[model samples]
Target: MVGGGFAGLWAVRALKSAPVRITLVDRGNHHLFQPLLYQVATAGLSAPDIAAPLRQILRRQKNVVVRMATVSTIDADAKTLELDCDGGNETLAFDYLLLATGATHAYFGNERWAAHAPGLKTLDDALDLRRKLLLAFERAESETDPDARDAWLSFGIIGGGPTGVELAGTLAEIARHTLQGEFRNIDPSRARVRLIEAGPRVLASFPEDLSEKARKQLERLGVEVSTGTPVKDITADGYRLGETFVPAKTIVWAAGVSASPLGECLGVPLDKAGRVPVEPDLTVPGHPDIFVAGDLATLKQANGKPVPGVAPAAKQMGKHVAKAIRARLKGVGIAPFRYRDFGNLATIGRMAAVVDLGAWKFSGIVAWWFWLLAHLFFLIGFRNRSVVLLNWSVAYWTHQRAARIILGGDDTRC
Candidate 1:
């Protein structure tokens, strides 16, 4: 095991009764619930509500041992991984390898822009954005100049994907409803939340009608939805959507995502996005002992469509890999991995969402309820779910976000 994410956790659980001893190594000590990270960034939820300590999650699994270390290199032929631990390299040899390492934000060759437009991918990223967002309003409250105040209140979100859409929607709600009557100098409802997408439509993977419905829901929340607008430059002032100049205090990059750099250590062919191209059984080509899954592996479906980089798909891959390993151990022929697409769900705002369930498609309050239940059900721990539900209920009724306190940052200027 090389990661502690969704794929890694699922794989470990599926092999609980197996005879093999599991050694899960990761740089972090917690398993994060990634889908709800947007809530943390938008002040709808706190960090602890979506993350759990890894040791506590697997304390009962006697066959598993979790190690905290960063993987530095992999000698594929030697079947050994060099981990940088305690300021030195520690090598571990393994008969079987499962690289479940996930993805990171992609800047598309403009990595420097990350200093200005931070992308929400981790706990720290969420906190950074939360501070930036809240501080923007604070700065706007103090600014007397109309133009400067407008710039401070404007928020530019790059991308119209699920994450981007969620961020934009929640941001609009926070500005328009959550913080209403809280500020004396500036009206939070005046905050401009813009969702910019280079694609033809928002949520491009969903059906055309559902995508349009999601756009309308966002618009209802006071979000400016702009499609076919690619971001060109980002700076301290704002971002340039292609040729258009938009002055914003905070810019969030929710666009492209590339697979982990650890995929390079596999010494296998990779896709354009730096994802390993694995075999049918989710194993490295010609190397049955090693497997790849999650966002790190790029495998296509029967219809030639690529498997989406979502939590469900990664969980399915992890479960399939476990089954394959068990079959190989039992001297049985392994079957090709087939991913099951349960459905796609994205919440727009309070009581607004769009869901695509194969033959069935729905949008509005019903889909919103489904989305809420699904997220609560899939949360890793009961404590997290309870806290998140309570937080959401409070926000829903009171129209107030409780986690708006900015924690840390050197220069707090928006």
Candidate 2:
């Protein structure tokens, strides 16, 4: 198995009962609960709360061997993978190939923007953002000039998707509540959070009404939502949306996403987004034994829409791949992969969220609780769920985020 995101992890988990021995290779040592990554960025939870050691998660399963390495090359003809394993290059052979390397945030032709605005995909990105955001407030507190202080207090978030919306809401809460009365010179409640989206509305994936509702919820929390505004440029100062220049010290890019470049090394035709084209059974074209799942594989559904790059879809792909592998071992053909639409949820602010479950759509406190329960149920480890619940419960009641410490970053500067 190549890669260790949700697709790879779930694939390995399902194959434990199969007759095959598994080797799960990944660069990281933990399986991160990606859905709750925004909480880690906003200081609502710690990193460990949303991540579990891979070794511990698979300790009971004796059939799985976890390797920490980066796959450098894939020779399809030889069915061998070259990896930078154990501080040296090693060639690992596999009978069947499963590529679940996943994807990274797309800068949309502006790769340099990554330095100015980091996207939240991994734990390191979250920590870097957390440090920048918290340091913004600290820097603002120490600034002598009002203009510079205001610039330090300002934040710009590019993208109005779930990740962007959640970030804007939580940052607003931190400014309006978490940091209130904490600084003498600066009123944290006055901090400005601007969410800029190139689209016509926020949460474009949801219904129009829910999108408007989410917009209102964000506005209620003091986040300035600017829709149909495309970012022209980004620098250390801030971003430019069309003709307007917005000054901000912190910026987050949650806009576009592209598949991992590992798909390129496979010597196969890929889509514009760098995703490997897959067959109905989630296998690469002309390579039945070589399966690709999750965000790395692009598969169009029967409805003519592409499979959404959510956690559920990735897990479904993983399970389907596992089934196909097991069927091959038993000399039976597996059916084509089918994705079940399980609805979508995006939190707005305190006790506010929007949920779209086909026709049974809802928003507000009920949706917020629903979102909480669903995430808790989907979290990988028991300890993670427990700690996250405890942290959220305390934050909900006290309006105080417990994980607000800024550690291991450059000192606060204006």
Candidate 3:
């Protein structure tokens, strides 16, 4: 087993009951709770609050071995996986392999702006964003020039998906409600949050009605939601969207993502997004001994729509692959992988959220509560659940964010 995101974790859990000797390899030792990463970026939660050590989580499972190493390549012809350890190189031979290597943020061919505008995908990214956001405010507090102050206070979020929407809304709340009276010179309440989307509507995966509702809710929160505007260029000064130039110091990219290059290493057929095209059983074509899952694999539904790259879908695929591997070992006929749609949920700040459960659809505060509970329940440890609940409760009652301390960096130029 390779990769240690949500999909990889679930795969290890499902394979616990099987007879295979599992060795989970990943670059990091901690498993991050990714959905709430925006909260971490916005200074609502700390890194340790949202991540769990992989070895600690699977210590009791003797069948699994956790290795911290970077995968160099996958030599399918030799049935060996090459890895780069801290001081040396190593290789592991396996009878069967599961490739759950995840995806990375796609810069839409403009990879140069990654350093200036970081994407929130890991705990490190979240902490860096937190530092940048807090430093911007700090710089704006003492900035004398009006133009510099305005640039420092303006935040730009690229994309209108759930991640982008959540980030924009949370930043709005932090600036307007949480930091309203923190500084004497700068009125943080006047901070601007602009959400840019090239598509006609935000949350294009949702229904038209829900997207409209989300737009209205975001507007109410003081977020400038701009649709049908594609960002042509991003620089340190700001970003260019067609004829308009928005001078924002802090720019976040939540727009696009591409699959890991493991498929390319294996010389397999990949989709437009660079995801490996997997068989119905979640195995690579012509290499049934190897499997792929999560955002790295492209699986289509009966309706011809590709399966979403959400955590639930990845977990489902992981479990299915584990089951197939077990059946193959037992000399039993394997069943085709089938996805169970459990609906989708997106929250807009504190008061509004949208949930679609196929036959049942919900919105508003009630839906927001449901969304909160579901995320808390899905989080890994009891400590994390308790701390997250406490954080939400305090934020709700006081309307103040606590984790706004900047770790390191100077934001005067930002």
Candidate 4:
């Protein structure tokens, strides 16, 4: 098993009582709840509230061994993996391999833009963004020049996806409500937060009406929503939208993502997004012993639409893979993989969200609460869920984010 994300973790857990021994290898020591990662990027939640150590999680399962290593190369024919760890390089052999590696940000051929506009994917990325965000306000407070101050205060998020929308909304609230009267030099409420999207509408995957409603909700939170405008270039000072260059000190990239490079190590033909096209049973074309899941694997559903790279879909795939493996061991034919459709949910701001459950669709305060409950229910550990709920309760009543401290950055001139 590779990666400690939802797919790999779920697969390992499902095989707990099986006859086979499991070795889960990952670079990170913890399993992160990625859905609420935006809250950590913003100041709403701490790192510990969403992440739990892998070793502690599987302590009771005696059949599994966890290895902290990075997979550098995979020799599929030999069924061996070259791994790099802190101690030294090593090669591990496996009877059956499952690559559940996730994805990272795609700069759309503009790799240089990453330096100026960072995308959130990991705990380090979130912490770096939080530092940058908090320092922007601090720098604005201390600046004397009006133009420079305005530049420091300006924030741009390039994308209208769930992460971009959530960041924009939470940022607007931080400026308009959370940081009210905190700084004497400048009013935090006056900070400019813009959500830039090249597409025709925000949340394009949702219903047109829900997309419009999400746009309105963002606007109500004081976010400057700009659609149908493509960014030409991004620099340290600002970003160019169409013909105009907008000065902003902080920029976030949430436009696109590409799968982990490990897929290429398999020497298989990949889709345009660098994802491995797996068989109906979630196995490699010629190698039935090898399986792929999560963001790394791509498959078309019965409706001809590609299965989404969401948490639920990954969990389902992991569970299915376990079942398939057990059947194969017993010399029984396993059924083809089938994805169950669950509704989509995207929260815009406080008391605002949208949910699409096929026949049933709704938006606003009720959706927001539903979103909250669903996330809480999906969170892995009880301590994490309780702490997150408590933090959320405090923030809800006070309108003040608790984890607002800036740490570990050398430069403060964000």
lDDT of each: 0.92, 0.92, 0.90, 0.94
Top model by lDDT, which number? 4
Task: Residues 1-414, candidate 4: write the lDDT tens digits.
Answer: 999999999999999899998999999999999999999999899999999999999999999999999999999999999999998999999988999999999999999999999999999999999999999999999999999999999999999989999999999999999999889999999999999999999998899999999999999999999999899999999999999999999999999999999999999999988999999999999988999999999999999999998888999999998898888889898889999979899988889999989898899999999999999999998999999999999989999898998989578534
Give the TM-score of each candidate.
0.98, 0.98, 0.98, 0.99
Model 3 spans with C-alpha error above 4 angstroms: 410-414
| Residue 306 in candidate 4, Cα distance off native in Å | 0.5
By descending lDDT, how would the candidates be arranged?
4, 2, 1, 3
RMSD of 3: 1.4
| Better TM-score candidate (3, 4) | 4
Q: Which tens-of-lDDT digit does each residue in 332-363 have in candidate 1?
A: 97679898999999999999999999999999
Candidate 1 lDDT score at position 283: 90
Candidate 1 off by > 4 Å: none
lDDT of 3 by residue, 1-414 (tens): 998988888989998877879999999999888999999999898888889999989988889999999889888978999999997999999988999888989998899989778998888889999888888899889889999999999999999999999999999988889987779999998999999999999999888888998998899899999999799999999999898888989999999999987778878778878999888998889898999999999988888888899999998998888888888888897778878889889998977888888788878898899999999999998999999999999999988776977886544345
Query: Regarding lDDT, does 3 or 4 come out ahead?
Result: 4
Candidate 2, position 70, lDDT:
95
Pairs with backbone N, CA or C atoms under 3 Å apart (clashes), candidate 3: none
Q: Model 4: residues >4 Å from true position, as ranges?
A: none
lDDT over C-alpha atoms for residue 209 of model 4:
91
- Residue 203, model 1, lDDT: 97
lDDT of 2 by residue, 70-96 (tens): 999998888899999777999999989
Whole-model lDDT, model 2: 0.92
